[model samples]
Target chain A: MLKNLLLNRNLTCLFFILIISSFEKIHAQNAQVINFNSLQKIYSNKSDTTYFIHFFASWCLPCLNELPDFVSFSDQHKNEKVKMIFVSLDMKKDSIKTLPQLIEKFKINVPVFLLDETNADKWINMVDKKWSGSIPATLILNNEKKYKKFFSESMSLQTLNKLVK
Target chain B: MIKNIFDFSLLVAICVLSLGFSIKGNKSSYDFHLKNVGGNFVSLKDYPSAKGFIIVFTCNHCPFAKLYPERLNGLNSKYKNLGVPLIAICSSDTITYAEDSFLKMIEKAKNENFNFPYLCDGEQLAAKNFGAQKTPHAFILWKEKNNWTIKYSGAIDDNGAEPDKVQHHYVSDAVDELLKSKKVSIPETKSIGCQIHFRK
Candidate 1:
């Protein structure tokens, strides 16, 4: 009986270890590192799904303040056709740690990506001619509706909802 | 393929046109007499011997701006004797961010041992006049025919986080070229930084 109990405890520990490792793998897979070309594809996606891509960095204070709103908005609109995507503009060197921590801290369930690009001068214009490479910028696009817009400042939950509708 | 090429050219034309418009738009006013941290107003006119100015829109609260105090000190120490002096301005709304208050700016300047004048744009007139979009945004103004003409604008350098690893010293290179009576090679470049809190 004592031997059986010990074996059972060991098996339970192994099962938990497997579960935790798998969770880590899933978390790692969710946060993709993308480039400027991939970003253009997302905005220019010819689909019915409305894409709301928010650009932010970990060091930007205002971006940090408004991140929870985006998270909550995504949570409330999970059943809708609108898809919320979070993109981190954090430096590529720290991206591996920054993005995953951001996902965990915010409990973000939607797709998350890191924009792995240097030279903001080149890509800022491609993203939006009006964007001055400031953090907390957002892009909303829907090919079916033929609607596309960009905001270069912090946004509120109410504003996000209104813009999507 | 021909149609795609035509469309690409059209897009490029529009981009160039818009870029021209923006470059011209920010040159409305180049003179400012804003209060410095030493409780006195300072302006380009004060530095009559100055051939140009390195005006950086910066503040106490921004993390990005915080990275550049030492860099700014270095730039000033290098260029001040060469007829170009560095001047930093805090044009962020004091109401929104109390950390950017003039008192705090003075404290920050003193603590950082600023080698140049740190001005407070209390009413944001200088920022609006200069069309400053974000903190740590740099502009190199060259005196042309007795008028301050904007010669270079944008990031101080390519890498803000790691100064030692910087490949492109945009501001310094432009200043050097201007000093040598040559046109700036790369006049403008974009930088990632905190947006200046403009009051609505």
Candidate 2:
């Protein structure tokens, strides 16, 4: 009977440890706030790697809807030298908490960076001249190796596949 | 004498380059015959009685746009009789964002009780012509002798998240200056908004 009680206690402790670990996994992925210069540095650092950069804001409903699509696309292209990074336009102070929550909710492990610049016009044209300072914009670059493309809208799975290649 | 001429030529080139950079490219407003939610066709030239019009590129689903339904209503009610009525256009591509389709726009207008004509830019021609980057973008046009000329372009206010937190009333201020026969002090201001999804 003593042995049975000890086994039951051990099982309860194991269950609690599992629950704590899962919680930490869900909540621990924090987003870093990056300025325009830093953002440029990141892309410029790896010229040979294909980069699929997505810009989104927390309040944008269309952005929220397409995020899962972006995650899935990144998953399929993980081994293809394509690096997908989500740059959020959400305020750094608020997004630190919300972004990870969203990542967990979507069940997608992805790199998210909060764009810290408030002067949107400064970087909007830098991203693409055709971009009129809009959210849910995606910019794809193969650096100096290939061509770069910018799309200023929410894209579907088919459109995403077509544009990435 | 040669050095003086060279300096003058360089100065002219500098001035030209500065001028080119300062003024953003301007495309004359496109002619649109869009249907309002009431199934009424709204043409820019239809408001002959008004001295000017407030053309707002807005949609139903954008969160920032949603914050200003009451404010827009207030603007229409307060300013329509003042000769600057509001004309809102939804230019999102209907195929991707079905909530912004013509029928959905009608239901939303009914629900919001939008007093102004909420027109649907089915082909997004109006948005393209106006260079509207996002939803809730406003362009103020004043009747200039024979034709309407765009005078002010940008956000309605500084805060789209909360009305009470507004610091700048860009549309109201511009309209006020126009009413007083004065140039708008701040002609343009950038706004935070959802990008208008255009079809490829």
Candidate 3:
């Protein structure tokens, strides 16, 4: 009886370790880096997934304030066909320190990218002529249908849901 | 009694009208005194050699402002020599974003190789004075016989993205017109940039 009990405990420990290892692997896969060029391809591939691109800066208060809402929205609809991407508008220098913390803190499961280009005006205009170079901006794209909308303010979960639909 | 009531009502009406006028007159101009990146008090009157002044509502973190740092530096280099000193005031609230702090402003200026004065608007008084709504808002003033008159108020340029695509260089054009003793051709334009983050 003593031998059987010890064997049971060992098996339980082995099970827990396996579960933990699987979790770590999943997290590592989730944290994979998605660069901008790949994102462009994703948007152009006519995939069924809806892309939600958020333009944010480390120093933008409004962007930080609205981040939690986006996280919750992403979580609630994780099973859906929606994919989220955070694009950091922080200067290339600050991105090295700030972007990773933001992704980790928010537990952002989707891809996150940093805008590496200089001369914001040129790139901003190229991204969307109506952008007006504002932070806390969002671009919702239905890549399958090639439909897009630009939101210049904070978003609510209800609004995000509606956009996804 | 009826005559007296009429006189009282007329007096109240005149008082209201005069108050409106006073408010309108007060909207003409106001003073802003704020600390610079070095923690020294900087005011409009500090530039004794300036005929007038240029106040630009800018911040260290806005990508829009970052894009035009060199342009603004060049503006300061040229305009200061021509008697118009430039002052960049950061009106973004620093309470939430520590990066916009006065110390960070100094670091940003040094990193960007700034040549002009960058002032910290602790309470956004300068932004309120000019009704600046966004980062990179420009207000140019000209002294007309010792009275500082606002010559131009608007965006720095029509094209903020590519320097080459700009159809109109509003600030430079206004300054040139001021130097030529002529009124600004375009007195105002819509400002496009990051919204000024005001503290709640």
Question: TM-score winner among the candidates?
Answer: 1
Number of the top-ranking candidate, with lDDT as the measure: 1
Determine the iRMS, in angstroms, of model 2. 3.3
Q: How close is candidate 2 to the true structure, as a TM-score?
A: 0.65
* Weakest lDDT window of 10 consecutive positions for candidate 2 chain A: A24-33
Off by over 4 Å in 2: A1-29, A32-54, A58-85, A90-98, A105-131, A138-165, B1-31
Candidate 3 chain A has its poorest 10 consecutive residues by lDDT at A27-36
True contacts preserved, each candidate? 0.72, 0.38, 0.23
Q: Please, what are the lDDT tens digits per residue for candidate 3 over residues B82-198?
A: 998888889888885577788999999899888888888888767877877778888898877766778787689876657787778889889988888888898876544678776
- In candidate 3, which residue pairs clash? A121-B161, A122-B161
For candidate 3, give the docking quality class from DockQ: incorrect
Predictions ranked by TM-score, top down?
A: 1, 2, 3
Question: Model 1: how far is B58 from its true place, Å?
Answer: 0.9
lDDT of 2 by residue, B1-200 (tens): 99999999999999998888654343454447999999889997787788888889999877678878888888888889999999999999788778898888989999999999999898888898888878889999898876788899888887665568676788999999999999999898775688787778
State the TM-score of candidate 2 restricted to chain B: 0.84
The alpha-carbon deviation from the true structure for residue A47 of candidate 2, after best TM-score superposition, in angstroms, is 14
Q: Which stretches of candidate 1 lie over 4 Å from their true place?
A: A1-32, A91-105, A144-146, B1-27
lDDT of each: 0.88, 0.82, 0.77
Cα lDDT for residue A61, candidate 2: 75
Over A1-165, each residue of candidate 1 has an lDDT whose tens digit, in order, gives 999999999999999999998988878777888898987887687888888989998877789899999999999889988889888877666666677777899898988888776567768888788788888899888988898899988899999889877
TM-score of chain B of each: 0.86, 0.84, 0.82
